[model samples]
Target: MVQVAGMNSMWSLILQGDAMTKCILIFLVGMSVLCWSIALYKLVLFSIKNKQLNQVVQELQSVQDFKNLFAVAKKHAKTLPGYFLSQSLRHFKELLLLKKSGKQEYAQGAGIDFLQMQMNQSIDEILHQEESHVSTLSLFAAVSPLLGLLGTVWGLVHSFLSISQKQSADIVTVAPGIAEALITTIAGLLIAIPALMLYSFVSSKVREIEFQLYILSDKMITIARKVIVEDLISVEFDENFMHDQLDRE
Candidate 1:
C-alpha cells in the first residue's frame, strides 16, 4: 500500500533524472553488487580456511616427530598448514639427500638456512593466495564515494541551469534537480560504507591467517634444526668409525 506507492514514486524520480545521473546510479548499483559479492565470497573462504587451519594446528601440536607431522600434513594437503608442512618435508628430504651424498657444505649450517628461506617463501605464497582480490574491495571503497560526489555536483549544476532558464525559483522547478542530487549522493554513501567495512573485516582476517602461518613456520624451523643436527652428528660418527676400522686393518 503506502510502501508500494513510495517505491513507485522513488523509481519515477530516478527515471526523471538526467542521463548523467542515471549513468551514475547504474554504476553505483553495479559497484554495490560487486562489493557484496566479494564480501560474501571472502567471508565464506576465510571461514573455511580458518576452520581448517585450527584443525591442522591442533593435530600438529600433538606430533612429536617429523615423520608423524609429515603424515598428518599429507592428510590435510588442501589446507594452508598442510601445504606448508608438505613443502617443508620436501625440502627436508632434499637436504637429507645432499648430506648423504657428502655435500657437507650444504648439509651443515648452509642447509638449515636454505630450508628456512624455502619455508618463508612458502608462507608468503600461501598468504598471497589467501588474500587475492581483497584490494579490489578497498579500491571500490575509495572510488564509490567520488563517483557519487560527481553525480551530486552534476545534478546541482543541472538544477541551477534549469532555474535560470525558467526564470522561476518555484518548488516544482527545483524539486527534481534536488532529488537527483540527493539520490546520487545517498547511493554513493551506501556503496562506500559497506565496501569500507568489508575491506577492514577481510584485512583483519588475512592478518590473523598470516600470524598463524608465522607460528607454524617457526615450529617447522625448530624441527628442521633438530633433524639436521642429528643427521650431521650421525655422519660424523660413521666417518670416525670407518677411520678406526681402516687403521686396525
Candidate 2:
C-alpha cells in the first residue's frame, strides 16, 4: 500500500512539471518575437537614412549658388538628409548677407573668435537633432536583463516552497519552477542583445553625420573669407549689423 501511494504522488508531480515547462517555452517564443520585430524595423530605417545622406552630401559639395542648393535639397527632402542641409543653407544665407556689407570678418573668423563660436553652436544643434529618439534603444537594452533576473528569482522561490511542502527531493517536484525561471532569463537576453547592437549602430551613424557637419561649417567660413578678400561683392548691411552685433560683445 505504501509503495503504491508513493508512485501515484510521483506521477502527479511529473504531470505538473510538464505543464510548467510548456508555459516557459511559450513565454520565451513570444518575447523573442517582440524583440526581433523592433530590431528589424530600426535596421531598415537607419539603412535608408544613411544611403540618402550620402547622396545629399555629394550634391551639397557640387553646388555653387544658394538657389541651386535649396532646390536640390527640397526635391529630395523626403529621402535625403534634409534637416542638416536646411540648417546649413540658413547659415550660408546669413554669411552671404554679411559679406555683401563688407563685414566679412564678422561672418568668418578664427577658431577663438565670435564667428567661430557661432559655428560651434550650430554644430551642437544639428547633432542634437540627428540623435533624437536614440536613447530609447539604450534604455530597453539596459532594462531587459534586469527584468529577466527578477523572473529567475521568483521561480526559484516558488520551487523551494513546493519542495518543502512535498517533503521529497525529486526532480519532478522542482523542475517546473526551475524551468520557468530559466525561461525568464532567456527571454531577457532575447530582448537585450539585439537592442544593444542597434544602439551601437545608430550611435556610429550619428557620429559620422556630425563629422560631416563640422567639416561643412569650416568650409563655409573659408569660402566667405575668400570672396570678401577678392572684392567679389560688397554687402549693404555689413556696417550696421557688424557694428551692432560686435558692439554688444
Candidate 3:
C-alpha cells in the first residue's frame, strides 16, 4: 500500500510537468508566429519602398512642374514615403508662388533662402514619417527578454510555494513552475529579436534613400538659383540697353 501510493504520487508529478512544458511550447510557438509575421511584412514593405525611391528620384529630376510631382505623390500616398514627398512638393509649389507674386517685403532677395528653409523642413518631415512605426519594432525586441525573465521569476516563486506546501522537493515537483515561467520569457525574446533586426535593416535602407534625396534637393536648389540669377542679369542688361537707345534718340 505504501509503495503504490508513492508510485501514484510520482506519476502525478510527471503528468503535471509534461502539461507545463506543453503550455510553454504552445506560448512560444504563438509568439514566434506573430513576431515573424511582423518582421516579414516590414521587410517586404521596406524592400518595395527602396526600389520605388529610385523611381521617385528619377521622376523628380524629370519634373518640370511641381503640379506633376504632387500628382505622382498623391497616386502613391499609401506608401511610407509617398505622403512626405507630397507634402514637400506642396511646400515647393507655395514657394514658387511666393516668388512669382513677389508680394511680401524682401521677397526678391530672400526668395531662394525661404525656399531652401522650406525644403529642409520638408525633408525632416518626410524622415519623421518614414520612422513612424519603426520604433515599435525596437521596443518589442528590447522588451522580449525581460518578459522571459519574468517567466523565470514566476516559475521560481511557484516552485518555492510547491515545496512549502508538500514538504518535499524534487526535479519532478519543481520543474513545472520553472518551465511555465520560462515559457513567457522565451516567448518574449523570440518575438523581440527578429523585430529589432528588421527595424535595423529597414532603418539603414531609409537613411540611404534619405541621403540621395538630400543630394537631389541640393541639385534642384542650385538649378533654381542659377535660373533666377540669369533672369536678373538679363533684365539689368535690357534696361541698360534701352536707356542708351533713348539717350541716342
Candidate 4:
C-alpha cells in the first residue's frame, strides 16, 4: 500500500514536470518496452534452437551415410541444425552430380571448393537468422544511461529556471523540479541494467549454437571429401559405416 501511494505520488510529480522532462520520460518508457519485447522473443527462440541442437547430434549416431544423414535431416527439417544439414546435403548432391558427369573441371577440385562455399553460405544464413534483434539490446544498454544523464542535467536546468522565475532562491520553489529531473536518471538505470544482461545472455547462446553447428559442418565436410575423393559410399552403408567414417578422420 505504501509502494502504491509512492507510485501515485511519483506519477503526479511526473505529470507536473516540464514538457522536455515528460518527453524524455516517455522516450525512456518506449525504450524499455521495445527492449523487453525483443529480449523475450529472442530468449524463447534461442531456447528452442539450443534444445534442438543438443539432440540433433545424438540422432546422427543412427545415420549410415550421406543419404541416411540427409533423410534424418529431412525428418527434422523444422529444426535449425536439421535445416543446416539438409542444405549442406543438397549442395553436396549437386557436387556429386557434377563429379559423376565426368566434368573435367569438377574432377580438378572445383566441386569441393563449390561445396565448401555453399556450406559456409548456409551456416551464415542460419546464424544471421538467430542473431537478429540481439544488437538492439546492446544499443538500448549503451544509450539508456546517457539518456538518464541528459535528464539529470535537464533537471538541474529546471531547478535554476524555477528559481529565476520566482525571483527568489528558495529551496521549496526548486526542490520539486529538481526531483522530477532526477527521476529520469533512475528510469534510465532501470532499463540499462536489464538490457545489458539480456544482450550478454543472448549473444552467449548464439556463440554456443554456432560452435555446435561448426562441429557438425566439419564432420559433414569430412564425409563429403572422403566420398568425393575416395568413393566410400560405393563400398557399404551399414550401421558401422558412419562409425568407421568418423573414426578414421
Q: What is the C-alpha RMSD of each candidate to the true structure, in Å?
A: 9.1, 9.1, 12.5, 6.5
lDDT of 2 by residue, 62-162 (tens): 66544455566466644435654444445555666666677766655532244456667867875676566676677768877776777677668878887
TM-scores, in order shown?
0.86, 0.67, 0.64, 0.84
Q: List the residue pairs that clash in candidate 4.
A: none
- The count of backbone overlaps in candidate 3 is 2
Q: On a 0 to 100 scale, what is the lDDT of residue 88 in model 2? A: 47
The CA lDDT at 99 in model 1 is 74
Which residue runs of candidate 1 sit more than 4 Å off their true CA positions?
Answer: 1-8, 232-249
How well is each residue in 98-199 modelled by candidate 3, as lDDT tens digits?
656764343435766776777788778767866776676676677667756755675677778888999878887776666656556656676777777877
TM-score of 2: 0.67
lDDT for 9 in candidate 2 is 55
lDDT of each: 0.79, 0.61, 0.60, 0.79
Give the winner by TM-score: 2 or 3.
Answer: 2
Give the per-residue lDDT digits (tens) of candidate 4, residues 1-249.
Answer: 999999998898889878888888899999999999998998888889888887887777665467667666667766788777766766776667666787736743887878778888877887887888889999999999999889889988978987888898778887787888889999999999999999999899899888888877877777777777766662222334333332431
**In TM-score terms, which candidate is top?**
1
